[model samples]
Target: MFGAHLDGVSAGPGINDNGSGSATLLENALVLAQRNPTMTKRVRFAWWTDEEQGLNGSDFYVRSLSATQKSYIKGYYNFDMVASTNGGYFINRITSTTAAPLKAYWDSLNLQPEENVEGQGRSDDYSFQQAGIPTSGYAMGAGARKTTAQATKWGGTANSSYDPCYHRACDTTSNINATGLNRSADGVAYAIWNLAVAATPVPDDFSMAVSPASGSVQQGQSTTTTVSTAITNGSAQSVALSATGAPSGVTVTFTPASVQSGQSSTATLSVGSTATPGTYQITIVGTGVVTRTTTYTLTVTGTGGCNGGQLIVNGGFENGTSPWTGTTGAIGSPAGQTPHSGTRFAWLSGNGSSSTETLNQTVTIPAGCTSVTLRYWLHIDTAETTQVTQYDKFTVKVNNTVLTTLSNLNAAAGYVERSLNLGSYAGQQITLTFTGTEDYSLQTSFVLDDVTIQAG
Candidate 1:
């Protein structure tokens, strides 16, 4: 605020001069009071009516407060001659004042909010600072000497301040600096946020985090990291773990990948020996107020040799068909019996009889295979004109775990193959079974063959 002015202040009623700041102070006070409990900090706003005629309103306020009441105040800010500025504004901590902290804060942001040219013109900050209180705030200024130093550093005319409507009837509502008002509003917002958090009323959850969290790391090394989020009132609703801000050649993999609610998750960060050594920052983005950042320290000092083995499984399929007699019959072979062209085919003669039972082969996973993929194939064709029943749906199982619970081999050229994730059952004996029985017309026949599993 620059200063408070009076309407026809010099000639008559002193309402317009100080009325604006008073109205503002009253509105601000009422709003703050209403939201006081919800506010993270306490806010104080006051109105000094009739600041004109000689700063009488302000003087009276000072004289009216008790010593103890005044002592509770952190600082006091004044708004005298605010609406009266034609020259740029200036603030005096006191005529010969020094408010370095407040000035420095303004200087850091490169704003020409106020000048100390006269050092002591007028305002509330003056009385407060004189009482050993630190004061700071922004004001709409009048046309003042915008120093080459302030201008070069802050940018504008090194010779002109902000406003040019100081103390004149030309100082209508239209003469006010909207830019100054907007900027002051923004400053107020920042002050409110900072104060609300600093008041110890409510914690600033913006800085919330995930702890025992991941650290930085270099490329090519495998490291485990734990993440825990400390929340106030609202624990992180859900934290998603991801790799980022790390050096090249570094890669990370997670166990659960994401944690929901207060749940915890561990991730495995791997950097290849080829990885570049450097610090890596891991970020967890979520509904949390703050974007929590944790790092996985990576020293890519060594090459990487750690990784999972290839998943492979060598297993046969079980169909009631004749045992895979390396003895080739006129019909086809067994199911799951082939590799990387990765297909399996089975053919059956049907013996011209309506075989009501499934023709199958027993798939025995040997200890030699790391993992296994089982495929079942069969072709059913009836030569007789009489209607026949097609047993097209079948079940595929890995040992007792049902990999393919049910599959409908509904094609005229009946064929179905399912890929199963069997990495967990490496080197373990497993079995694949396809169970389904079909009724065929007299002379109807089918073929089953090609059950295969590739090993690591």
Candidate 2:
């Protein structure tokens, strides 16, 4: 803005010459200050003290600022001689990205704004622009004549100075064009609001998730699952995929292993038949500008009673109790009075008073087995007068659950064949145990020959 004084001229009120620009700028500042608006950048308004003496006021202002202070100014916009009697809209010819908003504002109103071809470096904005700050402004014509084209567009008199009052005393209240001043004020507000405000930056980030996060697979087989990634904010970047905590014999791979942000990728998990049978937790990770993790659960089945034929390791005592564990009195396959399927049989004879003997074996029931049967030939001879009460006994168990108990008092004929239904324990791993006990009275004996478990 310029409030210059002409020492030699008598009618140098200078209202139209600079007062219009000064008033509009002050009004814009007042409205914004009253609202106490928050903006990313600071805005300051200035009114130059002299212009007729060669831009002295603006020159002195620029020279007073420090180099760091000057650099802080991003842009400068001058409003001088904006409202003229024959006013025509004009925008400063600023050749930079900052010029976009002003140009766009005019375009939005369907107004054809011209460049300041007449008064390029004749304003206060020139001072800041010279110090490397981006500068732009709007001006109604001064002493320059408006062309026929300008008259047609702005509805003004052609071939006449835009402001006839120029720097004369007549450049007072009567010299102002209300419509032109209002429109120019609006243009100033538009540029200030858009250019002075700072924009917030969005963070570059993404999220990850997996479908069917947990699953189960049978031994000797492989299973597959997927992992996906999605962008949350900012520009696209490559994201790499990986997996951890896979058990032995298991392999995990990602397809198109890396994907651009805002996009997704896939991962597959495979387990070999020889993979260990147990539960596992697998971690799937996505890494790039950002990182994320997810977990998956997988269970592998163990070998059991799936294959046909006898399931026990050594069904008959003819193998000398190779697969069975014995814990107590007189447990061995000694030459017996009778043999069930071989020349030798298992015998559990009382070792002393109040003593017990236990023999057990663990077996796996394979997959697809519906029913199981355990059959054996046994003999018991005890001196006890009563069954469990006198304490000379024999007992059988499956997986820690007692199945039967007997004593010689109720013993069967010399040698008896017994069978047990193991249908409920199908398709599982189980332990089978046999126990024999004797009281202080006398010794007792429990014998077994062929012991077989069959599954279908």
Candidate 3:
């Protein structure tokens, strides 16, 4: 879904404020209709109204979606004020998957775009984001002043507002930046075509494949493998290499930590005399604009002995929330909420009003642990009457990356066992977090208990 606000402030023509975005969308739509290309995914364009009045149109549209309808929407992209006279190119959530194509399009033109911090939570995209839909967007600028560095890169006077005529009577068609408009329009088309209308298979920006996928070494020995990358699509980009899951007394290094696409690097794994003896799965991660990972199995034989065990401390919440950190009163035994086991559990966000609560703990997984798994039991109860709308949400994240999300739509009567593989982070310290959010009207409780991170 692509969206832009059509309404403007009543103070002036508001040409540059939104006319630029509206024009860009209109032109793109016309071109798409003319071509009538085969589409891999459906494309929907929306011109919102009453946006200047606190994004009411977009918010209402998102709130009206049923759980099934929301699931069908892959992402949302917003374009607003893209042709400010002195505008600096900005892409919202530039590192997100939904924004990759937008950033790539700008990169292809040798233009470095910055994140659109000036417009955060001020546009229609924020409405979608609050509803758990992935969102990204493009913006030139608004009333914010451009810095000297921005002027040097984007060619405009320093200390000047991106649009001098912003919200004024002078903000007529003359306020538009021709060059910015042309460039931005092309980018919008590029993104729409690549995301929805492309008929050919979309190649990954790059690939990461290790030569020796598995190896065996004794304590005090070493092994080597080659990490190779190729530019499957677009121009070459720099990829940084790192390895994880090495046990204690083991060191993993790359000859050159970073490599350009279509290049290769050597990874060395050295084991010390005190290294633990076990079978380990080492994950090699290549990070660029996007991240790619591959696994290498290593078997270590040594005289030292150790047995796998649970890595998390006080996971069951019976000892209180010592190692865990979160909102006050979030971890405790509560009436009407049964714990999966023990006398306590984490109960987050049962308030029938707007509220947010979180619980997180950091733990290190020792080396030499073979099969690592995180397990928990979850129970959800909601006071929401609707069966289709997801009025409340629960999320689980590892190292700040989302692993799973649940909502009022997933409410059930009893506890359900959940398990996730943690082999990739076997020898790493990671933070696990559970966050719950409730809307203004409904109360939903996300209950968790019997949490454990076990390694064998």
Give one clash count per candidate, in the order shown: 79, 7, 0
Model 2 error, position 313 (Å): 66
User: Would you list the C-alpha lDDT of every candidate in the order shown?
Assistant: 0.44, 0.69, 0.80
Q: RMSD to native for every prediction?
A: 22.0, 26.2, 23.9
For model 3, residues 1-456, the per-residue Cα lDDT tens digits are 566452232112222233223344334444654553556788887877777889999999999999888888898988888778889999999999999988877776666999999989998998999989898887889899999999999789899998888888988877887666666666776777778875543444788899898777777889999989988765678899998898898888998999998899999999888776666888999998778888887766553322345667778889978888887387888897988888898898889899999888898866655667889889999999888988999988899898888999999999998988887876688998889999998799999888888764
Better of 1 and 3 by lDDT: 3
- Per-candidate TM vs. native? 0.31, 0.37, 0.39
Write one digit per residue (lDDT tens) for candidate 2, span 1-456: 212221212222222223223344334444554453446567887667676677788788888889988888777776677668787877777445655566665555556788877768887767777777777776787889999988898787999998888877788777876666665656566667666643443457778888888776665666666677676655567888888898898888888788886666666667677766556788988888878788987765544424434677666666656778887223344554456666776677544477777888899865665547888888876655564464677888998788987776655547788889886886688999988877776767787767877664
Candidate 2 clash pair list: 220-273, 304-365, 304-366, 305-364, 305-365, 305-366, 306-366
Q: Residue 301, candidate 3: how far off, in angstroms?
A: 80
Alpha carbon lDDT at 108, candidate 2: 55
What is candidate 1's CA lDDT for residue 298?
44
The number of the candidate with the highest TM-score is 3
- Cα lDDT of candidate 3 equals 0.80
